[model samples]
Target: MIMAYLEAKGAKNVRIVPLDADNEKLVKGDFPSLGKTVEVAIAAHGSSTGFKSLMNGKADIWASSRSVKEKEVLAAKGFSDLEDPESEHVLGIDGLAIVVNPRNNVTQLSKEQLGLIYSGQVSNWSELGGPDMTISLFARDENSGTWDSFKNMVLGKQFQLSGSAQRFESSENLVRNVLQNEGGIGFIGMAFVGKSKLLAISDGPAQAFKPSQLTVATEDYALSRRLFFYTHGQPSNEYVTEFMRFAQGINGQSIVRNEGFISQNVESMDASLADDMPADYVEMVKGAKRLSVNFRFQEGSAQLDNKALKDIQRLAFYMREQMPNSKLLLIGFGDKRKNEHRSKLLSKLRAMAVKRELSRLGIYPQKTTGYGDFNPVASFEGASKIKNRRVEVWLR
Candidate 1:
């Protein structure tokens, strides 16, 4: 969608050539801009295929719905660490929404329950407090990044998808299948939910949250994930570099929001203290409104990840233009720790890290606080623990 928008408005005398009649696989276009004609080709395959193409010198960028895997990084011969911030670019945010037929009474589920359903353990809707109908599973193909993310985030290593589950290459088709089947369940990108009913998902002890623009943007939703576009290190191609710059700018973010994904643009909304929240933490944010962006760090470190670094710049821009005089509060949370004091201190340090970054941009926050091991967004069992370590911004 971003590419199509750019081709229409940012370029002149555009020419499009489809490799196939459907134009679903390969496309080449000549976009005239800035006194030059830049030729660009896009191959719309599965995410794994994109990485394979990049490794084989067939593509300059790898568009993916999930993060690069360790094995893929090791396989790229000449590419710098694909996990590096320079190589990994977060395009936008998406939530993997569990959808079912609109007539289904089941409206919410725990992560564990979802795992069971997909693994074929809970094969009947009655098993989940729903109608007495046999459940049918629908899933993305093996090569799709959507499948990869769902496998890692929901299924995990303990369970594999049921052999009888139907696989789809298209999100729309999967949603359609679920819509037609009364007992069918499928996971899809939030944007593709269509007429299917969405289920609120809870992880660990956190409250259930449905995939929404705000929840996905804040990454509070259980299945929220980042969409990415990876380049070989810093992108040697001039056109690729220029396109990336445009995609990360304000106009590009607008296109992202318009296309039903959550853009990185900073926004604020009034929030009330929840009853389940800790009293002290609730008091801190009593009358404050929360921002759409959260500053999260790398695993086991205070260093901001690639997306958070970009968010700092976006937050700065937003503050200068919209809330120059607003008082900012930073609240940090951490995963469970054996030493309570150490956990609290570490959480505070994470907030301080964000403060320091914002300070460099001449945006000083008024207060920073830490709430260690309180209101975890995900379980502390595995890789999901990283989601618990984050700093949230609020306006007084």
Candidate 2:
């Protein structure tokens, strides 16, 4: 779904292909649309396999819906060999599912019940008040990306499947069989639940409910899954990077929701000046274009007061997640041109202070520079210079 979303965003040359880190005989691009062109290879496997392909250099974009694990990070022996090895990007979330046959009336199942179901201890449908027949089970294939994810989450080292359970090649295939067969249930990505009857699994009434963009957004849905699309460090091509930027934009998420997953609600504000940015002005600047705007700060200081911090934090969060490439120029000013020269070094220190705080919060590899008080509001010279003795963050 995420790969499809990117294609909808004018990423004309985008392609989704299967990949294998250890073997390529069955790992070739077998999907029909992928054969349309081999312009660039993007291996959108389940998260683990996607990372594997990324580390192996077989793919440009590694598509999956989970955060990279330490185990997987250790698996990146080859990714560090990239020209620029630190390139990593996180896109959006996909709500995971515990699907069952439409005929099954069980609207919600607790986490304990789910553990039992997967463990094979709860084998009969009648145990959960459905049919008298034994509950047939299925999972993704051994080499499947989803299978790797499930193993890490539910099964782990101690996990095992019963003899009666069956496995399929893909989630799409699994959903097809689960829908047609009675008393059969399976777990799948939420996007696949479209057109098929799905049961809502919940932990409690006040918060528990069916999975949707809304439920998942509010964290009311227990099965919300984080979807991801990774790249090997950062791509060397501008188009590949541009396509990634498009994927994180509103259009990509719109496609994600339209394709049957949940949509992300992006926060926005109309700025009167350089106001309404996240508390980290320098970080927020990275996400902003070269739009001219005004910002008011404390009367005599560059320090961010409590009230100003609130607005900046909101803007900064969105910027960091959405714009990974842009850098912010954190220029500080003094009361006058005379003060500017002497304040230049001090201003530089102030900008570095902001960068340090943001980097501590995990916004890495951003640059910051300071220019002393040369630019000020002409209308309010005295009062504004006091305000001008402030940090003016802008996009470069």
Candidate 3:
């Protein structure tokens, strides 16, 4: 969608050659800015196919809804580390919304309950305090990145999607089916929530949150995920590199928001502090607003992940433009640890890490602290627990 928008904006006499009845394989035109004919070939098969193409030298950019897998990184050893911040580009954010028929009264669910429902352990709506009707499941096909995210984030290793569930290749089709069945429940990207009802989802002890631009952008929403464009090392093709720059720039991010995905544009919103929030944490945030960007680390390590590296620059730019004189605060949180002091130290270190990065970009924060394990967004039991290790930005 972003590519098509860019082509329309900058290209003249654009031509699209169909790969099939539904997908276009080649888009070519004379782009005025580049002063040359540019042709881009896209294969919209699936995320896995993109990685496969990348490994074989058939694709310069692997556009994906999910992060590249470790196996894929190993298979593409010929290229630079696929997991490096240079090669892994986070293009946008998306929230995987759990949807149900609008008529259904259930408005929220915990992640464990969701796993149970999808795995057929709790097969009736009444089990969840809804109507007595038997639940019907709908899901994306296994090949879909959406399915992969849902499986990893929601189902984890303990549960498998029930065999009775109906699967569809298209989110719209799945949504349409869900809309027709009052007992139906399914998950789709936030953009596809459409007429179907969306459920506020909670992970671990975090309060249930509805998918919104703010929540998803902050990654406080339980199901939020990043959309990516992976290149082999730093892209050598000037056109490919240029296109990526455009995609991550203001005009491209605007297109992202318009297309119903969350752009990485930094914005501030009133903090929705939970009642269970620690007294000191609440006191610190008083009269302050939280930025939409969250700086998260690579699992168990204080090093900023690929997305956080990009966010450091975004946050710095935002500070200059929107809140140059505002009082800035950085608070970090970490997963539970056996040693409380170690947890606090590690969390503080994470915040300091973010502060150092911002300082280099000429944005100095006023105060930095760590809440340790006071608030967790996911259970410590699974890989998703990495969400707990993060630094949040706030402005007064």
Candidate 4:
């Protein structure tokens, strides 16, 4: 898309700049060229970092395998508050291809295995291999957004860097390294596959096949990601804006398809997909608070009523996600009117109702306790209110 557009306009000296932090830093001593209408340089940096390069005037344009970040947008808006910034565009769609060398006959790996490998657990080729060799893992530098997506989606969470691994400065280098190594696995922008053999993960959510143009378009690619180039807004430069239109328009999309990544156009997700998730991720519907519940039983009866049981069931579901790992305390509120012996038993039943209901729902509480007619939240002339006569979920 870039080459064709530059040629059509008769623009000269256009180069695809691989804008990166180091590359940006290199231009600190650059002196303005004597006379040149256009100059393009290629940098091998991630998308957000590329955006930074453009904003800081490190390059005429930057290429990336990711999209503008939320923070980058705020930064662009901030820069826009100052002077004019270059125009932005969405380059062709690109995804990170989770690849293993052709020598690797593992056939497929579940998301879990993929996570384990990258997290440095299953470190040997023999662990899931044909040869008794160490599994050579390659990864991109932290500066790359492609690296971020892989770490987030594949690793699930971050920890101290794995003690054994190889890091490359460029995505191009990472892809090449993976292709050249046996029993080695790594990720690179799908565009950089070249002659490397790609493997498929069967029954994957994205698809049940290998990484291919068909898989990407048909929604079978597991490692699909978006490619983006961000700018403050449309630039004041006619040349830059015109290039942006071509890059953001249909032409750029064609390049994206040729590059081997799936476009969000054929992408199956929403923008707010992350919002439906929790801050810690993993969709733990449980929340933390400090509310109390009271369960009261009849003077002589140790049986729980329908209302109490219903509330217990609710608390069970609400707490189910946290069960087995989280603890629950069941406190029974006893009625002020109680017989000496029955008082203990009545309060005990109320507590039992809650614990049993939770158990029935497969929500395990670590322990159950009974507090007979004790620790009343509210009392009218020492009388218990039915509203206070129930099991409550206490979130910690």
Candidate 5:
């Protein structure tokens, strides 16, 4: 659809070509009405290649499934500051969805369970409440962005996948493999979920959340990530800038949704909670001042991600300098999953995790408590459950 729109807007002789070394598959389309053709190179060599390709002048635009890293930006400094605001564009958002055979009765999984499964810590389906059978694991090859996201978001930064895991270069192939194996589980972009049943994921013990427009757009889904486009510096070419503008514009975002990825235009935050929410839960925010930092756990793990770790450092500094005498209250919230008692306990743990981290930095909260599944700042079902799975430090 983007290609069709571009062709309609007069981009001629547009051909997507791949380097001979690229092993990923290719997807191509043609718009005869506007005399344009767009070929998509699908080699799963990871997003790092996109930045390298852009810097070398081999590609006009790098369609990346992940954000640009600091090192990649440094590598591209010779030609253009690809990291510059004018050069970077967010095309869409996607959630790395966990998929299982439709016949599998398991409806949800904790991120820890997934990490264990992929890392071969738990090998049998019965371990996760399924029938007695070996759990077949399928995954994208290391070259793919999906693999990168899954490794970092689901598996911890240092954890390596099990040697026995099957690796596929194409998401379509990976999904097909999963379809044929009832005991198989794999991760893929929401775009490729198709007939495969998507497992609702939980960060801790909270209710499982599925990948949906609401979740992915708002980054409530644990594996939700941004999709990007990188150009050499500010895209000096007229056509390049126009195409980017269109990609970020309404029509492009519509196409993004149509392609099964979440649109960037979706609201980032939710302002209201469910009507049936407890009055006290809703009132918790009435008087206490909210913190600028929102501390959430890494998907399924107690450890914080790099970003959250940095945020924690900054927050500790803020508390020491800005509110030295003010009593800090840490409120933890959880997604609606399991029973209220369990959810509340999970929420409390999340808050405690934040408090513990702050304590190491010499900042301690006056009190910390968890509110089970109440007062969501984002959708609780399929989107941004992370918004609820958070610890908010308030000034009391």
Candidate 6:
């Protein structure tokens, strides 16, 4: 896309050489739209090789899935300081999805349980509420950035993957293998989750989260990580700088969206109950301060998602230590489901669900109300309708 856009702006003889460390071949097929003006040759190795290529002046750009490590930054001091300003650019965000065969009945797993499974401490499906069978493990090779990120996130950097686990050179192969085995479990980039069942993950049994653009952008998904493009210092070349800017700009972000990753430009926020709410709800929270967090539900369900579960812990602590005598107003909003009455009722039910969760945390709401289809963050038919179905917290 970037190449095409540049061609549209009338640049000539453009070429992009991308060295991929993930071992997957990058086939830069013909782009008739761009009139074949740009050439992209992708070399498969590991992220380390990309960095090596950059330092040795063999490649112009290092497309890395993971951030440049400290040791790597030191190695490229002569030619590039990857950490320097304008040298590193974030292209997109990807949610590392935990996938299983469609036949697997397990819909959720806690982070600790995931750690144990990958570490070889839990090898039986029965231990995790699955049918009695030996669990099959698939993983990315150690050379890949996906493997490094998974190890750092789930298994500590000091821990090694189970010896029994089968490792693949690419995410595509790992996902394919998992799909074929009923008891198979693995992790892959969200883009590779075709026809595979994605598991909702939680820190505990209380709440679980599935990866979505909203969730991943807000980092509600535990495994959400940023994708990067590293250049040698700040590129002084006109074509390189323009390409980098194009990738970081709105058009480039559109490409990121098209590629099945969360665009860096995607908006994510914990909006207060104060804005554009009903007059009554606004009055109720007139003198109150809004917490930096809000509650959200799973799609089509009244249950809180994993991020809300963690937010509850922080809110509880704040209430106990900072505002012992304060009162809370729980205001819920719903999308247009049916008629006005049904929308209103559904909204109330959502608020009540939040109240129940607060009760579990030993905190009680002084008042609660639901405003259905009232103030929407986006159009009802737009992709962001889910943002409207929420409960906001206000302290008085």
Q: Provide the lowest-lDDT 10-residue window in model 6.
A: 266-275
Tens digit per residue, CA lDDT, model 2, 1-396: 335544554345454444564222221222344444324443333566666666766777777665566566666645542212234443554556778877777777754466578789998878987778777787876655566555554554544666677887678878888888877788777777745566666432222356655445423345555565666666787767877766655676566667776544333322232343335543555455431211224444555433224324433565577655655555554444455466777666666656655566665434555555443322123221343444544553
Models 1 onward score TM values of: 0.95, 0.56, 0.94, 0.54, 0.65, 0.63
Question: What tens-digit string does per-residue lDDT give for candidate 4 at 67-142?
Answer: 4555766676756521222333435434457777777766766555776777788888777755677788888888
lDDT of 2: 0.55
How would you encode candidate 3's per-residue C-alpha lDDT over 1-396 as one tens digit per residue? 535554646778787767764444777777777788766787776688778888888889888888889888898777789998779998899999999999999999999999999999999999998999999999998778899899988898889999999998789999999999999999988888899999999998887899998889989899999999999888988767777878887778888898899999888988677778888888889999988888998875678898888888888888898788897899999888999998998889999999999999998899999988878877776787888898989999
Clash counts for all predictions? 0, 15, 0, 12, 7, 2
- Name the TM-score of candidate 1: 0.95
How far residue 298's Cα lies from its native spot in candidate 2, in Å, is 32
Instruction: Tell me how far the alpha carbon of residue 320 in candidate 2 is from the true structure, in angstroms, after superposition.
Output: 16
* Candidate 5 displacement at residue 358 in angstroms: 32
lDDT of 2 at 48: 63
Clashing pairs in 3: none
Candidate 2: residue 264 lDDT (0-100): 48
**Per-residue error (Å), model 3, residue 194:** 0.7
Q: Which segments of candidate 3 are over 4 A away from where they belong? A: 1-9, 13-18, 30-37
Cα TM-score of candidate 3? 0.94
What are the lDDT scores of the predictions, listed in order?
A: 0.87, 0.55, 0.87, 0.53, 0.73, 0.73
Error of 3 at 175 (Å): 0.5
Higher-lDDT candidate of 2 and 4: 2
**Cα-lDDT of candidate 3:** 0.87
Sort by lDDT, best first.
Answer: 3, 1, 5, 6, 2, 4
lDDT of 4 at 22: 62
What is the C-alpha lDDT profile of model 6 across 1-396, one tens digit per residue? 555555556656545644554333332434455666445445656677778878887777788778789899888787777765467776777888999999989999876688899988999989999989889999988777787778766776535679999998878889889989999999988999998999997643124678777666544466766677899877877867877778766677778888898775523234334244568766777777665445777666788754455456656766777788988888777788869988988888888988887789899989888888876533354323565687766777
What does candidate 5's lDDT look like per residue over 1-396, in tens digits? Answer: 446454656556544555667465544556577565656555446676766677777678888887676788787777777655566766877889999999999898887788899999999989999888899999998768888778767776535699999999789999999999999999999999889999988775344578876656546566777788888766777867777877776678778888888775422233334567667656764566655345666666766644466557656766676667877778888788868999999889988888898899998788888887775544464434556787766665
